[model samples]
Target chain A: MALLKIRNLTVRFATSTGSFTAVDGIDTEVDRGEVLAIVGESGSGKSVSMLAVMGLLPDTATITADEMSYDGHDLLHMTKAERRQLIGREITMIFQEPIASLNPSFTVGFQIEEVLRLNLGMSRRDAHARALELFRQVGIPLPEEKLTSYPHQMSGGQCQRVMIAMAIASKPRLLIADEPTTALDVTIQKQILDLLMDLQEEYGMALILITHDMGVVAETADRVVVQYQGKKMEEADVLSLFEAPKHPYTRALLSALPENATGDRLPTVSDFFGEAVR
Target chain B: MSVVLEGRNITQDYHIGGGLFGASKTVQALKGVSFSVEKGKTLAIVGESGSGKSTLARIIALIDAPSGGDLLIEGQPVNIALKRPDPVLRSKVQMVFQNPYGSLNPRQKIGSVLMEPLVINRPAIAAEERRALAEAMLVRVGLGPEHFNRFPHMFSGGQRQRIAIARALMLNPSLLVLDEPVSALDLSVQAQVLNLLADLQEEFGLTYVFVSHDLSVVRYIADDVMVISQGLAVEQGKREAVFANPTDAYTRQLFAATPVTDVEAIRARVAKRQAAREAAGAPR
Candidate 1:
């Protein structure tokens, strides 16, 4: 059985003007130890679907699904406490902006230790030791000193490492990384991606990487799901998807890559679907 | 072949942490870098964070004076450290920053935002003329005159970037220093903006000093490339030469680390795997 299964998932947010459908009905499933990549632009609902799965969306958001399950447990039927207990331990997520996601007021060490203690019921000393261990595992230099430093004191890469440490502290069965390397430089992005893949292998965790970067998807993902404006455009194994994209939107996106350009101008998505799509 | 902007051994140093009695520390952000941008050509400065690429951009744009070395704009020596720069000379070079949202004024209308440069630098121009130029600039950048009354908050990120580009062109600058101009945008919008930039450069015969960390974007836009690492230029040559065969170890490492999306290569690998599976008679 798949580790996660969702069918007909939809997410809508209430706004001052009207209701906004962020995620249209989409079905998704992830097997154990598999790497699935969700590729999309900014408003394509890639992040929103995962946020809905983690139950992290605000009250303004209304999420509905026909079937949503994790490890034989029904996610839709679970109570708030039960869902909370399942999410942070079994299924963890890291956001794009690590520095902004972390609490500015608290030390990173305290934050991770609190998660270890509350989620795993670890003793104080044990939580401290585990926090250090997680930090070291995430390749943070001088874990002892970084524990004392606030989020503001560290660089963007270091803050992301801290976020990864916090996410993997409880040894999650599935990890969701949303644009993990987007905020980093190319070299730093390479390092972070390698580290994430390494940790995913070590823990035997299913990884769901959500990014708009085709290069990253090509390099890391086994299977790919392309989203466009709250709709799933296409899905296939990574190589097949890249070699022969079925959807026009997918073809347009692949052509828009600077490396694939044959002329001075890059063909945009609108060029494929027309200006009406925009 | 005329050099529009030339930097000879440009250097920038920042003094840090000596508020009251303790000795200050001098950090060299740019360590004597030299380069030149030809007329109607794009020179890309590629580097990682804290690699001093942005410092070079600022120096080229005349926003900050270098601690040492000469900057010649159209063969005229410019040393802001020695004396004040002429307004005309300053107006010859314009800059477009990375984040369009943060760079634009939320309270100001788009029309006013476009005309602010002219109001400050070319005050002798009439208000009516400034308004005409701003609207025309807007149209040139793919935005319509109907967007004149709207605020920055009313526009999307792509439109906001168009407005930013239009504003930079108002003064008719010969050189534009774009510091990661499209990095904050989405991929599709990034391509659009890059196309717009290419069109505008052709229409105006503008020279560009583009500072970006993304090698792929640089490869697309840059005629000449300068790879900076740790405040030094590791390699500098034509874009094709540098990209095809980089001599510097740091440049090689950067190229190796950057993920390339080559469909043919991936297809070949996939075919090989399938062949292996077939040889083993694996079940489908």
Candidate 2:
């Protein structure tokens, strides 16, 4: 059975200009232990769609859907209190900016412990022990010492590991990582990605990896969803998407990558999709 | 081509956390870095974050001074450590930053932003000529003349970057130090900006010191490549040579980490799948 499902989901924000639909009606699904990547550029509504799934969208945004369910629970009909209980325990999210996501005033250990204590209802002593284990699992060096360091004291990579530790504190069945490695160095990016995959496999968790990087998608994703300007352009297995992209936008995006350049003028999306709209 | 810009033994050190006679730790941002760019050519400096590529760019662009180094522009020695760089050298070198949103003034119109550089660098030029020049630059960067009146916020990230590039070119600098100029844009938009840079370079005979974390972009734009790690230049040579066979361990690691789509392999696989479907008489 699919762990998460959305049908005809649409998101619109109320702006001063008027109501602008950011995400048009789109259907998506995530199966247990699957890695589903949503790839698109900024303003494509890829992030907004995922944010809606996690119930993280702003109050100004109106989300309507024919069906949106997670683990048989109707997300669209779920009350605020019920979602608050489900979010951290069963579903967790990590963001692009590691430092900003973390609390500066609190130690990394306290953050992880709080997640464990609140979500999993663990004892204070057990939570401390579990936090250390989580740090180790996320591949942070000197896990015990790192627990005491504040977010500012650690490097970008280490802080991201701390964020991961917190996210996986409850062993969430569904993990949503939005551009998790975008801010880190390439080497660190590989390490964090490897760690995420390892944890996902070990815990049998479904991962929704959101990013604009095709290279990253090729490396980590099992299935891919390509979004363009709030609409689903294509969806396929990772290999199939790369090998035979049906959508002109997806093909153009792949061709535009500098890595694919052959000492000639690059082919932009405008070449395939016509004049720029936005 | 002649050597347009050169740096020798560049090093930058920052003093951290010293108060009231407390011993402050000195962190070296750039350590004995050296490279030279040829006239009308692009020299790419590739590195991960905290690798001092940006520091090297700053020194080359005369934005910041290195603690110890000698900088030469067209074989003329310029002491960048001075509070203000020599006007002639400053005018000869310009920089474009990574963040288009922050680099451009939100309140200023695109026309004024483009004209500001011209007015400051060439005060004797007539106001009418400056306006014409700005409009021409806007059109040159792929934006229409109608966009001249728009504010920075009105333009998209890619368009704003074009304006930034246009502004940088107003002085007709011989060298442009672009520090991750297209890193903030979307992939397709990145290609557009990169193509614009190449076109501009050919048209204006401009040299470029391209600093980027992306090796693929470096391969596309750079004639020569330098790899920096922990404030040190690990490797430097022709772009093809460095990319084909990196001598430094760090450079090799960076290559291994960078992701590249195997287009040919994917194409072949796609063809094979198509053939199988054809043989099976699969419906579309």
Candidate 3:
């Protein structure tokens, strides 16, 4: 059975101008221990769809779906208490900017310990010990000292590691990482991707990687879903998607990569599909 | 060919953490980096974050003076640390930053953003002439003249970057120091901006000192390559030579770590699968 499933999901935000559909109808499912990648450019609704699944969208946004379930439980119809119980414990997510996601007023240790104590119902002493262990597991240097430091004291890569540790504190069955390494350097990006893959294998957890980099999708994804302008352009296994993209947009995207350049001028998506695609 | 910009043994050091209670320590951010860029060519500086590539770029852009070094622009020596850089020399070099959203002023109209450089540097030019040049530059960067009235927020990331490029070109600088200028845009948008840069370089005979960690982009746009690690220039050579045969261990490791999308391999595999199916007499 699938760990998480969504069908005909739609999200519309009430902007000052008018109601804008950020995410059109889309269907997605992630089986246990599988790695799925959602690929798209900005304003493509790739992040919006995952945000809808996590119930993290703003109140101004309206969500409608024919079916949204997790482990055979209805996510859309769940009560606030039920969602609070299931979200951090079973279905956790990490955002693109780790420092902004974390609280500035609290110490890193306190925030992570709070998650452990609230979600797993551990005591303060136990939560402290567990937070230390989580930090070590995430390969943070001087875990003890780092726990006391605030988010502002850490670098981008270290902050991201803390975010990952917090997301995996309860050993979630499904982990949604939205552009996890986009803000990081290339060398640090490689390390973080390797760490995520290692942890995924060790825990056997489903990972839904939301990213725009074709290189990232090529390296980490097992299945690929190409999104364009709030819609899915194509979906296939990683090999098939790269080898023979069915949609014009996917083909153009692949061709647009720097490595695939055949001439001085690159072939952009708009070049083939025109400005209407935007 | 004339050298547009040259740096000899450039170094930057920072003194931190020494107000009253603690002892200060000097950290070397850049150590004796030297290179030169010829007119109508590009030199790419590649390194990890905190590796001092950005520090070197700042020194080159005249935004920050190196603690120790000799900077030469078109065979003229300049030391901003000792004295203020001449306005003419400053106008000879301009910089384009990485984040277009942050680089552009949100409140200013696009027309004013482009004309501000002319307004400050070439005061003798009439207001109507400055407006004309700004509109022409907007069109040159692939943006329409009608976009001049719009604010930075009204433009998309790609369009904003185009506006930024237009602003950089307004000074008509001989050299452009682009610090990861296209890293924030999407792949397609990156391609468009890169092509525009190439076009402008060809049209105006511009020299570029491009700083970026993305090797693939460096390979595409740069004529020369310099690899920085731990405040030192580990390697410097022609782009083809550096990329094909990097002698430095750090450069080799960075190349190994960067992910390259292998579409040709996948295509070969698909072709092989089809051939096997055909040999087995499978129906189409």
Candidate 4:
């Protein structure tokens, strides 16, 4: 069964000149206990599409979707109250920058526990215990000490782990990771990916992994959806999509990556993708 | 055999905490780190944050003073005299920061930013000459001269980066300290930037001290690489020698975690994973 379904979704930002569609007619689905990666470049609209489904767009932004249902709930039509209750509880998200997602004023423990108290209806003591448990689960050293420490005290990798802990703390049916490892170092990135895979397997949750990295998608994702200017160019199992990318964009992207070899000139972005969209 | 820039056992210490007596704590940023870059070549320093790679670049760029050890520019030790020495070494070395958007002044036109350096250092080059130089540099970086009037904010992230590169090369520096220059861009855009850097190096005889977190980018552009971990040089050698035959355990771990360079191998691995996923996705 599909945990989250997005059909013909589009997001428009209202500018003084004119409204522009950031995400255009993107369609995708995430089944239970599956990893679906949305791969694209900077302006490819992968982030906008997921943000639209999350009901996180600002007042100036408008969203249009044929259907966006999460766990039989109409996400697109959800009231503000309904969406607030659902977010961070039923469909949690882990952003690329963890420290930014967390509140600087509050103790890391307080923020994590706050969600549990509100969503899980747990006592303060129990919520704090759960937060600590989550920290340990995400491989953060000294969970108790880390809980009391502020987000500023922790490293980027540690803060990201805290986010993962908070994200999985609720045991949401679906998790959306938006370039979770992009800001981290390669080794830490690998570790974070491994941690996410472990958590997903344990919780049996659906995952929407949005990233610009093809290597990351291949390593973790079960399926890949290649996006170009908010359009789905190709959808296949990670292996097939990588091994035999049918889309010219995907093929060109693969060829453009720098390699550790001799006499191989790196292909320019315009070499494959048309000169300039504008 | 001529070393353009060389740092000999450089150690930078920071004194933190302040009070009545200014209680100081010694924090060593670089511990006896030494490396050299040659003319018309690229040497990449690969590390994560706080790896002291940026500190190394700063020490080489003369942006920061080293607490210990010597920095030599073309065999002359960097000192007070050499530093403000009448635009000699200033014209020889330049730095391009990681955040191209933040690096360039948003208010200034692209041409003015390029002209700023030349006007300061090469006043002998007149107004018309400066304009021509700016246009030529912009063209070299793949941006058209029509953008001379445009601000940095008008361009895409990649184009802004091109402007930054143009600014760095405006003074015709012999050595460029590229600190995570392409790490901010999308992989596709990064590829284009990487290709451009390689071309620029050959054309202008520019030596690059490229610092990056991505091993692949380092592998792509660097002729030599030094892996620094926690203020220490763990591994250093020719690109092929270090990657293909890494001596240090940390370097090996990094390589293993990173995707292998060979596309055929990566494809094969992806094929296996996809087949398994397809089978699992099927009715079972």
Candidate 5:
């Protein structure tokens, strides 16, 4: 059975000038233990759709859908208390910037333990023990010492590992990582990616990985959904998407990358649009 | 080919955690970094974050002085640490940063922003002529005249970066130091900006010292490549030589970690998977 499903999902923001439709009607699904990558440039509504799923969008934004559900639960009509119960326990999210997302005032141990105490209803002693174990599971060095350190004391990569540890504390059935490694260096990015894959397999959790890098999609994704200007351009398995992209926009994005660039001039989407016009 | 910019054994040390009670320790950011860029050629410095690539760029651009080493521009030696670089040397080298929005002034119109550099550097040129040159430069970066009066907030990230490029080129510097200029743009826009940079480099005969974390971009744009790891230049050679046979372990690891899209191999794998699925009677 599909772990998560969305149909005709639409998101619109009330701007000063007028209403702006940020995400058009789009349909996607995530199977149990499968990795679904949402790939697109900025302002393409890749992040917006996922934000809508997590109920994280601001009040100004209006979200609607024909059908949106997770594991036989109707996500579109969940009550606030029910969502609060489900979010961190069954579904969790990790953002791109780890330092900004983590609270500066709180120690890493306190934060992870807080999640455990609130979501899982554990005692302080048990939560502290579990937090240490979680840190070790995330491959953080000197887990005990790191627990006492604040977000600012750790490096960017270590902070990201803490964020991962927090997200997986409850052993969520579904994890949504939005550009989880975009701010990290390439080598560190590989480490984080490997860690995520290992955890996903160990927990059998479905993952929704959002990013703009094709290289990341090639390396980690099982399936891909490409977005452009708030519209879905293509959706296929990773191999098929890379091998035979039907959309011209996807092809242009693939070709625009410097990896395959051999000629003096690269092929841009505007060139394709111009040719289409002609 | 004359050496437009040369650095011999450059070093930078940064002091950290100094307070009223605690003693400060010096962290060596760069150690004995040396390289030279020929006139009308691009030399790329590639490294991960905290590898001291930005420190090297600042030393070359004269934004920050190196703790040790000599800098030569156009065969003239200059002391970058103790004294201000001569106006001639200052005007000869300009820098374009990564963040387009933060680098530009949000309050000023794009036209005035481009004209300010010309007005300050070449005061003898009349206002009308300066406006003409600024407008010409605007067009040269692929922006239109209609965009001149708009503020930086009105433009997209890619467009703002183009404006930044225009501002950097206003002084007609012989050398440009671009630090991760296209890392923020979308893939298609990155291509457009890179192509524009290539065209401008040829037209102006500009020497470039490009610093980036992305090796593929370095491969495409750089004539020579230098790999920096932990404040040391591990490898330096022609682009083809370095990429073809990387001697450094860090360089080889960077190459392996970089994910390159190979459509043909993916297609064959997909075909094999389809065949196996068919044999198993699996649903599509």
Candidate 6:
């Protein structure tokens, strides 16, 4: 069964001037123990849709959809208290920029511990113990010593690992990692991706891996969704998506990437994402 | 110099005091770094963070001077460290920074940013002339004159980067120090920007000193590639030579780290790693 399903989900933000739809009608699903990717440019609304799913959108936002379900529950009509209860327990999210997302004032341990205590009803001592375990599980060095260190003291890669550790600490059924390794160096990016894959296998949790990197999608995703200008451009199995992308945007994205074997110039598509597709 | 820019045995160091109550501690940011780009070719300085790529670019762009070296611009020894930059020399080289979002002032329009460089460097030029030059520069960078009135935030990331490039080119610089020019843009947008750069280089006959972390992007645009690690130049050669036959272990490691987009190739890689680990752990 699918863990989360969205049908014709559209979202808009009410700015001072007026309201503009950030995410046009787009439908996607995440099945159990599978990885699904939503690939797009920066403002394509991939992140916005997922943020809506996690019930973390701003107060000036408006969401309208035909259907939205999470763990067989109607997500659109859920109360704020119920949505808060579901967050960090049944569904968790890890953001793109680790340093910006992580709280600077608190220690990494305290941050993860609060998630445990609030969501799982664990005591302070118990949460700390679990936080250390999570730190080690994510391959962070010297879990005990790092418990007292703030987010600023850690490297980008290390801070990302801490974010992952915190997200998975509560053992959520669905984990959404939004461009987790986008800013990291190539080697460090590889290490973090591998760690996430390994953890996914161990935990058997559904993953919604959002990224613009087709290389990462090839390595991790079973299913893929392509978005252009807040619309669903294409959706297909991973093999089909790479082998024969039906949409022009998908084909252009594939051709633009300079592989180890590609020649000097990368072929570019003009105004590729300016058009809307469904 | 036959080369437009050259650095001879460049080294930079910082001193930190009171290590172990009396000893002086030192940190070397650059160690014997040396390379240069010709008048109209691109040289890529590739490395991870703290690899001294930025430091090297700064030194060459005359933003900062080296501690121990001779910097020759057009065969003339420039003691930039000892004195303020020569106005003519300063106008000859420009740098395009990494963050297009942060590089421009939020309050100013695109026209003002481009005009600022002109007015500050060429104070004798009239305001109308500077504004016209700014508009022309916008057209040169693939942006229209209509864009001159827009703010930096009004443009897309890639467009903002183009504006950044246009601003750098306004002075008609001989060399452009591009520090991660397209790193912040999307893949397709990155391709478009890179192609625009190649076209601009050929048309303007401009020398490019490109600093980037992505090796693939470097390979796509650079005529030559220099690999840096921990503030040291590890390898330098023609791009094809370096990519075809990487001699250094670090270069090979970096090549291996770049993820292959092919699914079968990645699976084969993961399988190979698993087999190697299994073979190593096998007991008699």
Best of the candidates, lDDT: 1
Kindly list the per-residue Cα lDDT of model 1 for residues B74-111, writing each as its tens digit: 98889987887777987899999999999998899999
Give the higher-lDDT candidate: 2 or 5: 5
Model 3 agreement with the true structure over B1-284: per-residue lDDT tens digits: 99989999999999999988999999999989999989999999999999999999999888898999899999999888888877798789999999998999889999999999888889999999999999999889999889989999998999999998899999899999999999999988898888899999999999999999899899989999999998999999999899899999999999988887786654554466457547756443
Model 6 interface RMSD over true interface Cα atoms: 2.5
Give the clashing pairs for model 6: B1-B75
Worst 10 residues of 2 chain B by lDDT: B265-274
lDDT of 5 at A66: 98
- Candidate 1's clash total is 0
Interface RMSDs of the predictions, in order, are: 1.5, 3.1, 2.8, 2.7, 1.9, 2.5
lDDT of 5 at A148: 100
lDDT of 2 by residue, B1-284 (tens): 79999989989998898899998999999989988989999999999888888888888888787899898999988885565765566679999999999999889999999999778778899999999999998899999889989899998999999999999988889999999998889999999999999999999999999999988889899999999999999999999899888899999999888876775544554466457547756442
Candidate 3 wrong stretches, greater than 4 Å: A274-278, B263-284
Which pairs clash in the backbone of model 3?
Answer: none
Q: Give Cα distance to truth, residue B33, candidate 4, Å.
A: 1.4
Q: Is candidate 2 or candidate 5 better by DockQ?
A: 5
How do the residues A51-118 of candidate 6 rate in per-residue lDDT, one tens digit apiece?
99988899899999999998889899999898888888879999889999888999988888988898
Give each prediction's DockQ, rounded to 2 decimals: 0.67, 0.44, 0.43, 0.57, 0.59, 0.47
When summed lDDT is taken over every stretch of 10 residues in candidate 4 chain B, the lowest stretch is B79-88
Q: Which stretches of candidate 4 lie over 4 Å from their true place?
A: A260-263, A274-278, B80-85, B260-284
lDDT of 5 at A264: 91
- Comparing 3 with 5 on TM-score, the higher-scoring candidate is 5
For model 3, what is the error of residue A271's alpha carbon versus the real structure, in angstroms, after optimal superposition?
Answer: 1.7
User: If you assessed candidate 2 against the hidden native complex, which CAPRI class would it receive?
Assistant: acceptable
The digit string of per-residue lDDT tens for model 3 on A127-219 reads 999999999999999999999999999998999999999999999999999999998988889989989987886787899999999989887
